[model samples]
Target: MTLWLCQLVTSLQSCLQNKIYDGKTLTCTQTFENPMCLTFSHHCFLPSWLFVKFDVSFIVHLWHVFLNVHIKQALNFSDTYVVHVNVFVSLQVIKVYNEDNTSRAVEVPTDITARDICQLFVLKNHCIDDHSWTLFEHLTHLSIERIIEDHESVMEVLSGWAMDTDSRLYFRKNYAKYEFFNKPLDFFPDHMVSISSETNGMMNHSQLIQTFLNSSTCPEIHGHLHAKEQGRKSWKKFYFVLRRSGLYFSNKGTSKEPRHLQFIAEFSDGDVYTLLSARKMHGAPTDYGFCVKSTKRGSPRDLKLLCADDEQTRTCWVTAMRLFKYGMQLYQNFIQPHQKQKTPMRSISENSLVAMDFSGHKSRVIENPSEALSVAVEEGLSWRVASHSLFLYVSFRLVPNEHHHGCPVCFAALHMAQPWFHSKLSRDEAHRLITQQGLIDGVFLLRDSQSNPNTFVLSLCHTQRIKHFQILPVDEEGELFYSLDDGHTRFADLIQLVEFYQLNRGVLPCKLKHHCARITL
Candidate 1:
């Protein structure tokens, strides 16, 4: 039967190629090999006499109909037959720029999310998935940019963009995207947060985010912000309240009354963006300027420009707006990476290892957490001392003239090799690099102090603001050391200082977690 169908198909193909058909009964006497026709033996059956009066086009149509019907039937018998389907997926071309302005064009599915794009780049660039990588939408004309939420559709965002605009997508680290989940207090100061009138104005610091997520309760973020008046260049200070419904400003002095509360904007129709040069571009009073950009309008005139007194204030407002808009979805984005981690970060053998004390000739595992921590610290200090002694010995052997100079010169050169250390970088440049990388707590870099050539500065980000700590050179016992606290706590080199701060917060606001890095792709 299969051989006969193969011959029939061959005859039809010959007729189609010649553009000729006769109104005569067809017979399958000519032998031909067709691998495809044999698979339809059990799935389909056709009477040979049906093709007696048919033309070439009718035969082709009938063949397709039978093939489709047989294919549908074969799908039910999964063990015996397999069907292949060709599905066309819509694709979009998007260009993502790095910190150095180098761009890479990527072809992704139209429905790809921002998180998926970040993950793609992470794999391509061979970067660690620290959850700090973020996608930013930069509008060149307005000089404003905003972090695209992880779940936001990239195609949807592009749909809102005008073709003539010079808007771009940036792939970079933005640690602050989910920093609020870790440091809720820093993101939401107690003074800025308040409960609705139904309950006492007091709010639990631990449950502050819970209040925002709970639709039943109304959590308000109230503060005084400088707002740029509509169609005017001048700005005025107004008491603003941000709730789940929308943002409102009090016409009267800090009044929460319904009559005095005038609506400013809502997050449902707008997105919050940070101004690149607030003072220069928008004549903003301060550099900490953020605006509510309407999704429907791309012009700067449609923006609801607002400036906070400080970075913390601006972060509080922006973070609150995100929570109000996305609610639990933002939280899910924060924890989704962790949920995908199938294996434990630490192996079972590593987890079983504990700190052991051997000072008493007999060794015993330290049960107390504090005792274990102290033992670990002591071991770390001893190892550093041994390593330092070895470094001095090696220097003495390698370069005889440097024996008297000690390890200061060698230590200074050590930081030059570190990725976080950008020598001779100005304070402003350091701030820019850290800001471009991530304006989250503990994102830091080291640079030479412009004012004092002998010292270095540690530029760190905390509460969405950049801060510089001067590391002055301290001389003690003919050995040069670096210290942030005048000669109290000293380190042999800037590397040691940075490593110490990474483990211990000490005088800094937060422990260093991420270093600002630039990669050429």
Candidate 2:
């Protein structure tokens, strides 16, 4: 089947020679090996098709549509070449991060919406399409990134990217992403959604707009504060309230009447940052300090300085001020979590039970091609005892029964005891978990391989892809050596191997990033 398609493509390329345009002829000079074709029932007006080279699917979908139905009538074998070749559109290839962090550079039609690309992969990979997959446009250099909404175009998104090179489009899981839009309460915590005395000290979702609509009842964040006075050398503590009007402190207590209030400052058009030299600058409270400055582009000034009693208080005040300043976008970013489009593809369940095969590998499909399926089946039951002596066994230390403490092989695992590391997950589950927070390059985990029982597989997520490295053991001089690079670079044990890979990225895609941490206190 592949060969027949190859021959057909070659013939089509040879015949598609010249094009006549604007009375002057321009040769169809470029030889397209892997061309994409889109056809219209009537005729297309596309000048040409040009994009990154991708195999089979391009020709199957594009050529099949154009050649039989549309292009045959337009073909010209001789000069005067009166042709009306009407269909061809090629798409660019972008790397998509699969569930296990593995990357597949897939080509997609340039003109279609981002949702189309997700649907293509869902069908191609035979995944149960549940429609949660997404294409993330990351303009890393420009410091701008966002999930390409279902309605947006892939080419349009790429065109907006401003970078010399290093821009990327990520394909991964984002379940809670847009969930915030429908369920905003899940995204905004209680502290951030507080109601002040401005709304009679109580407000709900329905009342939120009504409360803020009237300037007189606008939400305000007020609390006790230690502030710097202009004329006074000594600092004094006062009851401070942040309202739409401005930051004000009561001359006496938490009194709202005009007589007892004094205006401190207003930060309608400025920004805030942590004051590193807080103690030296304005005698700010030690360690619990942050500063706000006016963003008057050219001119720089050491304006108003405020201090909080603790870091938490400082964070609350600064956050409230920011909510006050950039209300809409910031609030949207908070409530409307960046969600990816949903698919119909089957999602990997976290509770799916897995059992080991006879050879003691994670019992995945017979993946080690070197072992013949018939032979593996023949020796499947007794194969464990057969390779027992030669195979220096290494399994995941994250398993509950495995005592990681004081074991040299599990030094990294014991220290990096994250929840994701505690279980063996399939590629999709891994991708979903890693993307739950962010696709940090070095996020990684350890899982038992169903194909190889003598070794554990390291799943490292990097460059928006998951790379697998099999830990193999070699017995030399009565000592076991573990290696990922086909025994080229061997470590005394798994500990040394993990440590070496963390700092020096040898064969692995990227160095081991921080382990997934989950702490509840």
lDDT of 2: 0.53
Estimate the TM-score of every prediction: 0.72, 0.36
lDDT of each: 0.77, 0.53
In candidate 2, what are the lDDT values of residues 1-521, reduced to their tens digit?
Answer: 45445655564555444332222322232225423332222222221121222343555455545444323455433433323333434546666654334667766555666666766666566555444567676433322234555655677656644445566766665543344334333333345344665456565654553343444556666777776666554566888877777788898777867888887666665555445345665575564455455535212134455677754566556655654655554434433222423333333563453332455555554445555555556676567455433233443223334553323343233323433353556655554455443444677766556577546777776644556677786655545567888889987655556778789989877888544432221
Quick one: RMSD of model 2?
15.8
Q: Residues 1-521, candidate 1: write the lDDT tens digits.
A: 44445667766444334422121221112124642222322211222222322332455565554444444553344443333322222456789998879998876666678888887788667778888888999999899999999999888898999888899998888877887877788888888888877767666665788887778988889999999999999999999999888999999999999999999999898999998999999999999999999999878789999999888898899889999998999989998988869664565678898878899989998899998998889999999899887755443232235554443344326778787888878887888888777677789988888998668999998877788999997766555678998888998777889999999999899999899876555
lDDT at 251, model 1: 99
In model 1, the number of clashes is 0
Q: Which residue ranges in model 2 land beyond 4 Å of their true spot?
A: 1-200, 203-217, 230-234, 280-282, 297-301, 335-337, 343-521
Predicted structure with the largest TM-score when compared to the true one: 1
Candidate 1 Cα misplacement greater than 4 A, ranges: 1-87, 342-412, 436-441, 462-465, 473-481, 486-488, 505-510
**Top-lDDT candidate index:** 1
